[model samples]
Target: MASAFELTRNMTIGQYIPTDSAVHRFDPRFKLVAFGVLVLAIAFCNTYVGNLFALAFCLALFPLIRIPVGYGVSGIKPAVPFIIIIALLQFFFSGSIAPGGTLHFEYGVIRITGDSIRLVIVSAMRFVEVIFLSSVLTFSTSTTDLTRGMECLLSPLEKVKFPVHAFALVLTIAIRFVPTFAMEMEKLMKAQASRGAEFGSGEWWRIIRRTKDMFPLIIPLFNLALTRAEDLILAMESRGYVPGEERSVYTRYRSKGADWGLLGISLALAAVILWLP
Candidate 1:
């Protein structure tokens, strides 16, 4: 998961919070579809009011989902710097200026054009909008359900010799291991902590020095993962598990009328966003 967001930063995809809320009970397909539409709306929303509407809507629904607001909000922390950088770049390179307006500078070589600044603000809004929405989806949904939903959705691709099932299997495997990887990282941290790794060292050089001291921990963690993977393969082989084997899925998902309605509404929203003035 390699995310910098502390809320979700310490975990992997497989470790999404378990809940019995409506967010969890709803068909996985419905949730995924709703997420896609919401993200598209945020991305294409062109005005401040639109962005505000998104924030308000999220605020209203987040509580209903029974998810901790702090967790969802904190998951976006990792992207803040990226969003800021994009906005700055857009501001300078927008190439939009007025005939009689004066340029101003705050940082080096910063020529402030009205249009450029506006675009930058818009870009920031879009960035925040996307990250926050994505965080909400991830925080509210389990990786297992998401992978299963994808496999089901793409099953039609199997008709063209696409190995759709295999693709889904790989995706499921990758997502299922995210939390395991994070736990491994935490183990490595604890191992180094016992050896006096001063993580709080303020200086970048000191931080580097401390991290360098943990090389022994990383090596073991990597070795452990490889060993575990080999063991997993052996265990599966003993159980007669074969790749590309057709089997009944215990956690099958079915789309219902509500799901169809959600999809319809999503498409309508997409159409409206694409046609916005």
Candidate 2:
């Protein structure tokens, strides 16, 4: 396919879709905390029922947040191949260390067992849930909101002279540039194709050829990323931005009762999920 490098369509991580839903109206700080709690819960959960419940809970947020189910999950398109590889790897290789799963198949260096299969499926489910939940967060929150929320949440560390604002700024910028970089890569791929360079001609499952084809993109992509970062630095400097300087808040966020209620619900949900078998 000629659209191998068309990453923006599959990248929903940094893309924001504005909506007036209650979830969007909630304080970003609360949202971040709740998201973190849910992430930890998802990471700790290993049972099928637990993961399914988590997945369902995350999916339920789509309607609540006014994000189309299809659009919310579009990001999974590009990740499917990698997920398949990981699932295959775990299914084939993990049986060797599994304690007592029923054996399904065996070969000299390959084996399949109930435990291995469960591991693969559970891992994939976790990946999907995390990705979808993340998409929900970024889709609702703007870049400035994310940065401000993170800084506010981490402000306690400033007592230890931690650079909370700087760290938040760096993290936010990194997240916000994901879509930007994807589009830039797409442009570069088109440019190279215009110059008679071959790309995306190999079959998707042909890992070796695909990898080889992508080799030419790494250096130029990195160079362009750096240039973009430099441009950002110059722009910030031009605007008199100073890291670690005391800055006045242009907008102060006060948590509402609904924000607290949502946070409590998140904590409760996490506890319930973690308690699941």
**Who wins the TM-score comparison?**
2
Q: Which stretches of candidate 1 lie over 4 Å from their true place?
A: 1-14, 84-112, 203-239, 264-277
Q: Which residue segments of model 2 deviate by more than 4 Å?
A: 2-5, 96-99
The TM-scores, one per candidate, come to 0.71, 0.93
Per-residue alpha-carbon lDDT of candidate 1 for residues 1-277, written as tens digits (9 for 90 to 100):
2231122353322445666666667787677778778787777777666666566666655576676666555545545556666776877766645787555554555666776776777677767666555555555677667767877778888888787766876776666665566667666766556677644344433434645655766778788788878887899799887878876777867777877886786677556555545
List clashing residue pairs in candidate 2.
Answer: none
lDDT of 2 by residue, 62-170 (tens): 8988887887778997788789889989989886545655889999778888889889989999999999889999988999999999999999999999999999999
lDDT of 1: 0.65
Look at candidate 1 and give me any clashing residue pairs: 12-178, 12-179
Query: How far out, in Å, is residue 77 in model 1?
Result: 2.9
Leading candidate by lDDT: 2
